[model samples]
Target chain A: MSDHLPSTARKPGLTSSAPSVVAAELDPPTPRKRKAPGPRHEDKRVAILRTAAQLFADNGYEATSLDKIADQLGMHKATLYHYVSNKESILYQCLVLSFGNLDAVMSEMEDRSVPPLQRLRQFAHSLALAQNNVFGRCLVLVGSRPLDMMPGGEIRQFQRRLDETVRALIVEGIADGSIKPCHPGLVSSMLFGSLNWVPRWYQEGGKLSIEQVVDSFMDVLTSGIAAPRR
Target chain B: MSDHLPSTARKPGLTSSAPSVVAAELDPPTPRKRKAPGPRHEDKRVAILRTAAQLFADNGYEATSLDKIADQLGMHKATLYHYVSNKESILYQCLVLSFGNLDAVMSEMEDRSVPPLQRLRQFAHSLALAQNNVFGRCLVLVGSRPLDMMPGGEIRQFQRRLDETVRALIVEGIADGSIKPCHPGLVSSMLFGSLNWVPRWYQEGGKLSIEQVVDSFMDVLTSGIAAPRR
Candidate 1:
């Protein structure tokens, strides 16, 4: 029963041989896959991406090679070309996955009837949760370089769409006097810079749970910590 | 005379070849040599880095190459290698120059009698300034990957040291009643995160100047845009 669950959420499996992107997908060895004679092709593809992400993250992207990725995955190097056309392809896929997932979560929150502040809190939690899977690791480890190679132009547009939504929320909050009248860009800069950069310092066993991490940031940002400047 | 002022900082007519670090000491244009070389070698190095930073920032790091860097510089492939060992070294040098200069500015502020908030302001300027210079472009282009082989240990330690200093100042501000008592880590996280990440979107000659960029961030951070609650 436990097999279906993603192994660990935020960051427990350092040496468990789970590549950052594919490890979570491996849970619960599903019932249908056992009949095939070949190794699970989907799983292998995920594994390749997982391996590629690690190599890309560990060694700078240009330094990582397909042979090395295949060697690490214990397969012929050419085998991976079937799943991904180039090393860069894996990076692009990982980013699309991360950004796509993030936008979906935030959009889902926007549909709720809650106040903008409540919505933000929900967002902070949802944002934290996305990192539990493979896509989150890729986002942090690789940074923001992949957006350039994208042919879809979807990634940037997606981000802009999301930013507009957040800005609208902020503007609403300001107009009604429900929250602070902060610059949308500044609030966003702080929120994202702190959240995006968290993966760098976050350890699985840090005193704070991911929830606490979100709360710590929200508390300061929403309600300035000084005793009301009186 | 003003045209020569920047040259006074380096050699007057030396070709601004992309100097490679392969033979670090032997290849370096010494202080005198660099001065005479003036706007040539350093300018080329700066130009190459400017082009690379935008490319690296636009595309992820792995997708960029020395050959690509040379192409952007309108130079031949072999010529690019003469400036650095490999793409990773370029990334490293880019970051090191940025970080190294930031360290100098922070220390200079440290010795001054400025208040803690003012000190923070100075630090912000120092960092933001680098984002526009030959050094900052290097740092911002490859800033997040500390464990990257090129700058590896030294780079990470330097970042940590700076982070700690920022944290300490935030704590001091809180304790002295100059600033509110927010989570020190989160404060530093938000402040440093936003400050360091500025290069991701800022462009010179854009609508906002560097000072304007710094002001935009500082304005929101120093004073909450939220109204004083009853």
Candidate 2:
């Protein structure tokens, strides 16, 4: 990412780059209404989540329907009501599943007394892992929504908690004099932003292991190899 | 962004940090959404772009609709047909407008035979500027859709063109011994991914200038601050 290798070259590297994105806070007119009733079933719940994630991934959240999801699962439309009450619930659940793992990773970091910088490396690894899963797209889509979803809501506050945790981690690093004192928010943004965007360009069965990618990212992100005196 | 800040006396200085989004593109949605064909055409066109961008940004491309857009605009459903024939057209226009300026930025950078590294700095700045606007969200939404709008579509070809362009730029620096020979794809992704996600966090009336953010990004991005010792 350094400057001045040359002004012109043979190929554009990441030039085709574009960002990509979910959910049921959408309000299109309903085509049909069905009575909401069903038993609390577990398999049905899992099926609903799995189906909704696909639909949400494919069609976006607002355009998907409980009926369509029900149809995909080969179940009655009303039967979906028993498993998940509304499309919004499905949206929230998909989000919870995606972001929930992030919280777990951070907590695990807390359990260790690793130095601040090492902890940051742990964050990069965990973040890459967390964002690379099925829940990754769900996380991107859900986070894109600009609505003031209830501040107290789990999804909304969950991000806040995560932000605080990341910031605290960065702060701890700075205080120990092991990290740079640049804006932690910007640093955090750069850190997670790099990880958050992995889902956009990364393919599942590709050349580099997740570990190699993490190391490369850390090399560029943390300690640039260009010696100042040189 | 260092790795060794200690854990004690965490006299946190980054607490006031608010994550700022240095997104990739931000444009008002394409002009006119009224499909019904009627009075105040100009107003209607801009209105459609406004509503559609919000919907697409919040919802997703396939999920947002002409009808929902009209409803958001407070215009009749049929009125939307006048401005755009369909959602796909709106998506294309929204994106084309977002990309329109990029071509200009590259051209501006071309006038001066700046060092390849400086050219990259200029590239990063222009990209960061594009993201600071309304079109950034538009790019993110439409960029995700897997569209084949034209027969023998060059979406694949255009992406190739873009890749070639970036690769050439990077290779120039490498050949000139100005930058290292790293994975161009990974570097490209890291630079863009970090820049594109800026909108998700940055507020319009924030403390930092676009250049400040850009330089900071380019600093950590291009050359890490770790001073080397003998």
The candidate that wins on TM-score is 1
lDDT of each: 0.59, 0.59
User: Which CAPRI category fits model 1?
Assistant: acceptable
What is residue B163's positional error in candidate 1, in angstroms?
A: 1.1
Tens digits of per-residue lDDT, candidate 2, A1-230, equal 11211111111111111111011211112456843223234444655787787787666665578888888999997777755667765665566556534655667668447876677778788778766666657666445362344232455566666667677877776676666666777777777777777776677789987777777777777664222332
Candidate 2, residues B160-224: lDDT per residue as tens digits? Answer: 44445555566776676666666666766777777877876676678988788878878776675
The regions of model 1 sitting more than 4 angstroms off are: A1-48, A77-89, A99-104, A143-150, A224-230, B1-92, B108-113, B144-147, B150-152, B224-230
TM-score (all chains, Cα) for each model: 0.71, 0.70
DockQ for all candidate structures vs. native: 0.30, 0.26
Instruction: List the RMSD of every prediction in angstroms.
Output: 9.1, 16.2
